[model samples]
Structure formats: structure tokens, C-alpha cells
Target: MGTQERKALEKQLRRSQILDAARMLLFSSGIDSVSISGISSKAELGVGTIYFYFKNKDEIFAALQEEGLALLYSKICKFIEKEPAPEKQLAGIAEAYYRVSEENKDYFDIINYFLSSPRIFFEPGLKYQIDMSGHKILKIIQNTIATGIETGVFKEAQPGRFSIMFWGTLHGLLHFKKLEHTILENENHRDLYEYSVNKLIDAIRCQ
Candidate 1:
């Protein structure tokens, strides 16, 4: 590459470093405590460099959250690739969600902030991500429902209403299973996610 290209690439690398540092800090601590100075120090960038990339901490957070969510979606796409059939895809999606939750608790913590927290909601210039998290998994369920209609898998997928019901079912059940164990001792948060999904599939499966 040319000298200018090299310089541009180096600048981009620095920006990514800042972003990565911010995410790590937020995940390690809570978002409420992260500061531009801390992130810049962590990234080895000048404080002014941070401003060049992001207006403020909130903007940095918006970028980090969006990037992490895209990673989740990309991972989901990989899980979908493994399942050649719709039924299997639904199961894989359930499994994928559970595995990702276990592996990236920090990411899910951030996800929760985006989902239910007032911080993301009330903060100006900070865009909260959409509730397409379940959509990342429920695409499989929705597709299965649609394909079922064609090949007699389900009676019919009420497109107007079923997506919400189906996705809401997944979301509600997952959240309950995720938190139930913490509230009570010796309660194992097992494959209730997959089981709940299977039950829904069973209910909707066409005879």
C-alpha cells in the first residue's frame, strides 16, 4: 500500500483499539463508571483521538453495543448454516442462545442494559439497539412455522401476530430460565430454553 494508505490504516487501527478498550472496560466494570480518559489510556490513544472517533462516552457505548450485537447475529448466522432443515434450525438456535449466554455473560449483560435499562432509554444521542435478539434465534422458529404451512408442519403462521407471540415466548422463557436460578438456591438453569422451544414447535407442528 501507499504511504497515505498505511497512515489511514494506522488511524483506523487506533480507533478500533479505542473501541475494544471501551468494551472491555464496560464489560469488566459497569458502563456507568467508564470514562473517555480511561478508555483512551487503555487504548494508548490521546484523549483527543477519542473525540475524533466518538463525540462522547455515550456515543462510544452506542458503537460498542452495536458491534457486540452484530457479533451475536453473525454467530447466529453460523449456527443457522449448520442446520439444513427448519426444525433442526430452531433447535440449533435455542442451543446457540444458551451457549452464547454462557460464554459471553458480559455481552448479555450489555444486552440486558439495552433491553430493560433506563440508561440506554433516557440517555441522549445514545441509540438503543432493537429487540431483534430473539429474532436472531426465532428466525428459525418463524421459518419453521412458514415452511410448516407449506409442507404441513404447522397449521398456519399468523404473520401479523405470530412473530410477536413466538418471539415473546422465546424471550420470556429465556429470561426466566436465566434468572430463576439466582433467585433460588440449587436451581439448575438447564435446557429449559431448548425444551420450551421444542414444546412450542410441538404445539405448532402440523398433523
Candidate 2:
């Protein structure tokens, strides 16, 4: 590779190293507990190097959140591409979400942390980017519902509103995983999730 391209690749690798460290710290500890020094230690990089890539812990955290959301959006798109039916597309979207939580727990935790905490402040630009990332994902869901409606497979309903409710319900149901051994003892969480998804599909199906 050319000198300029090699240097660019190296810079990107360094940034990934720092972000990976910060993600680990965010998942193991809490966001408030993550620090540049801790990330540098976790990454085995110099503090100066960490600062070279990120302005502060908040910046690093924001980067992680943005990266996680983008990854989710990409995964959802891939899942949708693999399914031809709108009903199957919605199910694929739900499965993709669950797989991300199971397989990419670090990203899921970082995204969930910011989403569940409304008190946290983000710069307007960063906030808008994050909001747009989420909106894009929701748009896919909304459009899928609209497609189903257009084909006469789904009952007439407001796609935009139903999309929000659908996503919110799935997200809320996922959180119940923490209660599996307590309130949900003897219940299969996956079964519950699938049941919820099916019921939502049934609700909009033209009878």
C-alpha cells in the first residue's frame, strides 16, 4: 500500500483500539466510571495516544454509541434483504435485534445505556446523528408495514405509529430478560419474545 493509505489505515486501527477499550470499560463498569487513563490501560496504549484519538471520555462514549447504532442499522438491512415477505422481514428484524444483544453485548449495552437514560446530554450534532440512526431503522420497519398494507396482507393502519409501537414493545420485552429467574421463572424468554412478535403480526393481519 502507498504511504498515505498505510498511515490512514494505522490511524483507523488506533481509533478502533481506543474505542474497543472504552466499550469494554463501559460494559464492565458504568459510563461514569470510564476514563481516558482506564481506557489507555485497558488498551495498553499510552495516555497521549488515547488523547490523540479522543477529546475525553464522553467523546469516546459517544463514538461507541454511534458505532453501535450504525452496526445495528447495517445488520437490520441485511436481515431485511434476506427476507422477501413483509411478515418475514419483520420477524427477521426482531431476530437481528435479539442476535445483536446476544452476540454483541458490548454494543447493545452501550446503546441501551444511552437510550434508557434521558438525562444524559449529547451535543446537538451528535444527538441528531444518533437520532437519525435510530430513525432510519424505524423507517425500515414503517416501510415494511406500509408494504404489507399495500399488498393487502395487513389491515389498514398508520404505519408510522404502528412502527413506533412495534419497536417499543420489542425493546420493552427484551428488558424482561433480566427478570427471567425472578418474575418470569419457568418461562422461556425467547418464546415470550416470539409470541409477542406473532401477536403483533396477527393484530395487523387482514382477517
Candidate 3:
């Protein structure tokens, strides 16, 4: 192996170690309890070594949250790849969203933590950088909406705006479950998810 390649690979490995440690600490101890020393201890590295990779706990958590978003985006992309029709794609994306949440509840909580925080909404530059991963997922939704409009499966509307509505509704439903509030108490949980997604589709469909 080339000397420079080896160094780069080693650096990446160290960063991954720090992130893994931080993720464990954040989940086990809550984000407010995470600290440089805590991560260093968890990672079995010197505090100074962790500093070399991340500036603070927030930075480390932000990186971890980005990974979670990337997971969701990848799932959406995979579902979209298998479905050509826009309506079907939308349904697939909704199912994929819930499927990821069901499988990675902790990761989903990390995402919601970053998203619902006022800091991201108040700070434009920080919001942009942190939301980039989410924007990728949103772009997929926007494209599906645009395609639906073109195919006359959906009513004429701004794709971006509708994308927000679609995503926000799904997030709200997921949030209810996270909060332990049984809005869909009588119905099977997955049934409620399908019901909500179908409702969104019906609302957007050309009548």
C-alpha cells in the first residue's frame, strides 16, 4: 500500500471509532450528558486524540445524525429504484420511511433531535449544512411529486411545498409513536402508517 493511502485510511478509521463511541454515549446517556472525556473513555483514546477529529460533542453528534439521515435517504432511494410509477414511488417512500424508523428507532430519535431543535431553524448557515442530508431525501420527494403532476396523477402544485407537507405529516405520525401517545390506539401501528400515506396520496391525486 502507498504511504499516503495508509495514512488516509488510518485517519478515517480513527474518526469512525470516535463517532461510534460518541453514538453509544449519546444513546446511553442522552445528548446533554455526552462530553469529550466521556467519548474518549468510551473510545479508549486520549481526550486530546478525540479533539483532533471533532471540536466538541455537538460536532460528533452532528456527524452521527448525518449518518442516520443518510441511512433514511439510502432506503428511500432503493425503494424508488424499484418503483417507476410516481404514485407507487410515493407509497414506497412512505413505507421505507416507517420501515427505517421501526428498525432504527435510536437513529430516528437522533434525526428528530437535530430537526426539531430551534437552533437549526434560527441559524441559516448551520441549518443549511446540517440539513443537506435531509434535503437529499426531500429532493426525492419533490421529484416524485413533479413526476406525478406531469403524469396527471397529481394536482398542479409546487413540488417543494407539497414535499414539505408530505414529509411533515409522516414525521408528525412518527413523532406521536415516539412520544408514546397512541393516536392510532385501536388500529395496528403499521396499519395507521399505511392509512396516513394513502390519505396523503388521495389528497394530492387529480380529481
Task: Write down the TM-score of every candidate.
Answer: 0.74, 0.92, 0.87
Q: What stretches of model 3 exceed 4 Å from their correct place?
A: 1-10, 119-125, 178-183
The per-model lDDT (C-alpha) reads 0.68, 0.89, 0.85
lDDT tens digits by residue: candidate 2, 115-146: 87877557787788778879999999999999
Per-residue error (Å), model 3, residue 131: 1.3
Across 1-207, the per-residue lDDT of candidate 1 in tens digits comes to: 999999999988887898889878887877778999999888988899899988888777776566656666777678879866666665666666666667877666566566556444425434523435435444655665577577765676674366557666755665776577477335555656666778876776666
- Decoy 1 TM-score against native: 0.74
- What TM-score should be assigned to candidate 2? 0.92
Clashes of each: 2, 0, 0
**Model 2, clash count?**
0
Question: What is the alpha-carbon lDDT for the whole of candidate 1?
Answer: 0.68
Q: Name the best candidate (by TM-score).
A: 2
> Candidate 1 regions off by >4 Å?
1-12, 27-29, 118-144, 169-187
Error of 1 at 18 (Å): 1.9
- The local lDDT score (0 to 100) that residue 31 gets in candidate 2 is 76
Colliding residue pairs in candidate 2: none
Which scores higher on lDDT, 1 or 2? Answer: 2
